[model samples]
Target chain A: MTTPLMIEARGVEKWYPNGFQALRGADLSVHQGEVVVIMGPSGSGKSTFIRTFNGLEDFQKGSIVVDGITLSDDVRQIDAIRREVGMVFQQFNLFPHLTVLENVALAPVLVRRRPKAEVQQQALELLDRVGIQHQAHKYPGQLSGGQQQRVAIARSLCMEPRIMLFDEPTSALDPEMVQEVLAVMQELARDGMTMVVVSHEVRFARQVASRVALMADGQVVEVAPPEQFFTAPGHERSRQFLSQIG
Target chain B: MSASPNLSHPQRTASPPRLHRLRRELFASPLDGLITIALVASLAAAATGFLHWATTQARWAVIQANSNLFAIGRYPIEQQWRLWLLVTLLAAATGLSWGLLRAWPRADRRGSAWPPNDTIAAALLTAISFYVPLALHAQAGIQMRWWAITALLLLVRAAAGRWGPLVPRQLRPLLALLWPVLYLIGMVLISGGLGLMPVPPAEWGGLLLTLVEASFAILLCFPLGVLLALGRRSALPLLRWGSVVYIEFIRGAPLITLLFLGQNILGFLLPGGLAPDRVWRAAWVLTFFAAAYVAEAVRSGLAALPPGQLEAARSLGLNLPQSLMHVVLPQALRVALPATVGQFITLLQDTTLLSLIGLLDLLGVARTVMANPAFLGRNAEVYLVLAILFWCCCAALGLGSRALEHRLNPNTVALNTSAHKA
Candidate 1:
């Protein structure tokens, strides 16, 4: 992987319309093909932090440069960044009206203006890779939570994105279904896709992530390689978060 | 047979026959027995009465062409066929198409909870009972166009089932756009423009003209309403305020007054010699008034969409127009379809108000029938027919919305049914 840094964020701050500061001076950087896991307690801005990478969440004062394009009020550039960075929601917002195959193929056909046959073929292949090819014709509502999450992953991947962000993709899954979704993510990570995952799945982070960053109080308290971050942490907040979630 | 599978097990006890179960259910309580008995007796009596009217006691209604005046005004007798055929075809085709789309399945037989079967049966019986009066009092002619339109509706329904296979998805927008375009062409040609086979605006009366005017109003109102909705939600203050004032003012007053204003007030706005035909003026006024109400309905749909949908589209690299067109409008229209149909029914009924401005719509023509010396007291009969026509149409539209809502809510049904069973 010879590509340079895919994302860089500095001094990112967001104050919601209701005066809640979701992200306060959050800073992060992601190099090409790097897997960064963001772990934190609930409402600690970890999900918001990852969402900013794809412009799903906007910040009040920050500079986010993704894939060499700057993020601002200019609609054009933000769209460009979003095309390169795909964010999967915790809710797995697949269109309920469409089949799993159509859901994956929709953005490719509509937004990317790809040929129908080519997109459909690629979507089928992605579904196969996610181990849900047989369920392609069925709707999301007809599938289990884990199966829907896998379809969501394949949908994001259909855009042929350079970076993927997962915001607790397994949080909504049944206990028995969690491993099925995590297995798909594990395969993607092994294939060298750059990923920023915000989850409490400590075992997934320990096995796959090159580096783990602990976020607390709308800020990244510490970032370290998996071996040290799990074994020893510098910040008291990181220690407390790990102790609670481990 | 194979050791009797434990007689104590509930499954081994033969299930009660369905008829016996029904008997128990219907006769288990005194209230149910009373209701069932009353219902059966009433139905029996009604059926006997209807049979007598249709078969034994009634004369066939036939319009007498020899003595009856053709077209009611200066219309050529040859051209009268076109209008009469157009009318019967429109009515019967509408009724038949409505029945095809929404007729319930055979097994349900729950006696239509919404429009009770009794209301339908009573209406049919009454129509049959009035055969003698109708047969003696009316006149008609041959109907080539009537058969043609009936055939066309059959073709449309037969083809609609194969719509997915026959129609390309991309062509759907054009298919939707067709009705309004054709309506515009019809209005222009019938209302006399382009110097090609012009039908004079004053001569436009009867059911054909009523349909033409009402459909034209609907066609014009939809786009105008959509534009108004967009304007009301626009960022610019001038456009927003203008839309609000337009919507509120038109909705505040009765449509009859608007027609009056169009007839009387607009003469002041235009130069004396440049004023359009009064009929055209009334058409525009009706279209504008309807557009306001339709705009509010569409706005309600727009407001119901979740903000996440817009954000999701924005994040997907869709610009404002793309987002609105692909995401926002599709969802909004799905929600707004029933309301749009409701607005159309209102517009259809409102066409009668044009009679106040001297246009001879169906209601206006019915009133003319009442003025005839022989038919002086037949006002009840004419008005009854008119009421039935309007009621049938409005009821069909309301039922269509309910069917569409249910079709869109299948998942909710499964969830609800499971919850109920639990």
Candidate 2:
């Protein structure tokens, strides 16, 4: 009864200017402290759907209400929404000029106008949490892919965001390095943060995510508890995707 | 598929038979050897003549003695120290700026350190300090004020360098603004603001005029260039068009034409009677010319900034102006700084063209002195010194630009290192 529904999306659709409809009508609902994983083949609108939640990508027709704020075309609201929804990209967009500590501290200092001392302390703590505290003074270029991804996570967490979104966070890493980033993510999920992850790492989804949502051709083909979804997917498209990706 | 017997034989590890090859290359034939020898002899003769003229036979001692003649023009011998002090102040400022920017936090131990360019700077400053005092011995007693002014300038520079970091971010912008104030003070002091001191524009000659023209133009034009660049990219159509017209129209013509227009037509254009100061008008015209070029450089800087930077700043909730000053402009101006400095150097060299309009700058003074009966046939000597002075100025600007470019883009250095090793 106390489960708080943090995000609700109904009939989300995106028709880009060039007449490519990247997303079809899709409905999703996520609860507080729940991990949801979205898996799909390439060009299935998995990334596009997640990007819309943070307002990085706007949809043409949809109703998305996150944390009680409704999505609108108003740019101001988009910024406000972005502040609460922390996103980590496949390519860690850490500012090259800034050291790891500075990169983590930037949003807090610039966005929240936090005191420098407080922000620096929080930045270091987040870096420690991500297991890159020792490399705080080094730039993103100096770090390994795994370390950079961890720093990116730390940077997002520095905002103290309400919800975390990971868009193929480990996809760019080498096979050996991918586990380190996934392990950090696994720790975040265990800590009971609300998270929506778009990833192909099926083992990660099976172990952590409460529900697995399978998307195909811009539509959610299946949504079921991971145990049932993987073992007995209802839809033929979901069954085929699992066979291919697994 | 069988190997040939000669090829299958193990190669002997031995030197080939040493042929007594002639040292001469293709010049073995009689006609070629004669032509090569003649060419070598002619080159040697020319080299010897150049060395003798450039070093041994040059009248450097007399030129050194009358250096003030080339440094500051026919200004009263008594006021020569003022010009010397100004040069020393500028040199000290150059040194201080170099030191401040090159200084890094003590924490960065693993980072590569720049070679001590500051020592070269210090040596240059010392040379100026020594030369100024030695050259102005006649007026050294009474012109202690000049030395005091130089010391004050040095103190300001040192203070700015040392305490600059401690100044709040809000005040750092005002740091750039201080140059205009300092320029005004120097101008007033030189133009008889002090009852005891007086030097008119007509008398302001030599390298001092070059400095005056360059520094004044930079102070006036740099800000105008920024405005024009911003205006050209403005959302308002009227502003964009106006700025584009201004920049393009000025750039389309030559500097001499603008100077001529400023001298001849400016009085008629304005209702207020134009000031009778030809040098001021010329400086204004040069500043106008420079602003157009500077605008183009700044526009390129603005264009180079990533669109994400602007979006990020906006999403941080900063207003348009705040985002521009805090985020967009800072990065853009860093990209633009070296180009602006290059333009400043070009403006300095272009100041020599002021001689065409009868202003007695260093080149003007040199031409005047050469035309006199006393210094007849010394055009080569005067022009040689002028060329050396101009070369030094241009070289400093070039080096400074390279250093700044290296700092801004260390990836270039990294790429070069990898290329060199490979």
Interface RMSD of each: 4.0, 3.7
Give the top-scoring candidate (DockQ). 1
Model 2 lDDT per residue over A24-79, tens place: 99888999998999999999999999878877678999799988789897867777
Residue-level lDDT of model 1, residues B1-422, one tens digit each, is 33234334535446545655576678768999999899999999999987776566443221122112212433444445445444444444444343433333112112122244434643553454345335545422223333444455545444443333354556544544544554455455444457645566677665655676777788789889988998999978999999999999999998888888889877787667544777677777878888998898899888988776676566556667877876688667667778888898999899888777788777777766666665556554456556776787678668767766655542554454464456
Q: Report every candidate's CA lDDT.
A: 0.73, 0.77
Q: What's each prediction's TM-score?
A: 0.78, 0.75
Enumerate the candidates' DockQ scores in order: 0.30, 0.16
Q: Looking at model 1 chain B, which ten-residue stretch has the lowest summed lDDT? A: B105-114
Show pairs that collide, candidate 2: none
Model 1 regions more than 4 Å off: A1-3, B1-28, B31-78, B81-185, B192-196, B230-245, B264-275, B396-422
Compose the digit string of candidate 1's lDDT tens values, residues A128-197: 9999999887767889999989988998898888999999988988899999999999999999999999
Model 2 chain B poorest ten-residue lDDT run: B13-22
lDDT score for residue A74 of model 1: 79
Q: How close to the true structure is residue B165 of candidate 2, measured as C-alpha lDDT?
A: 57
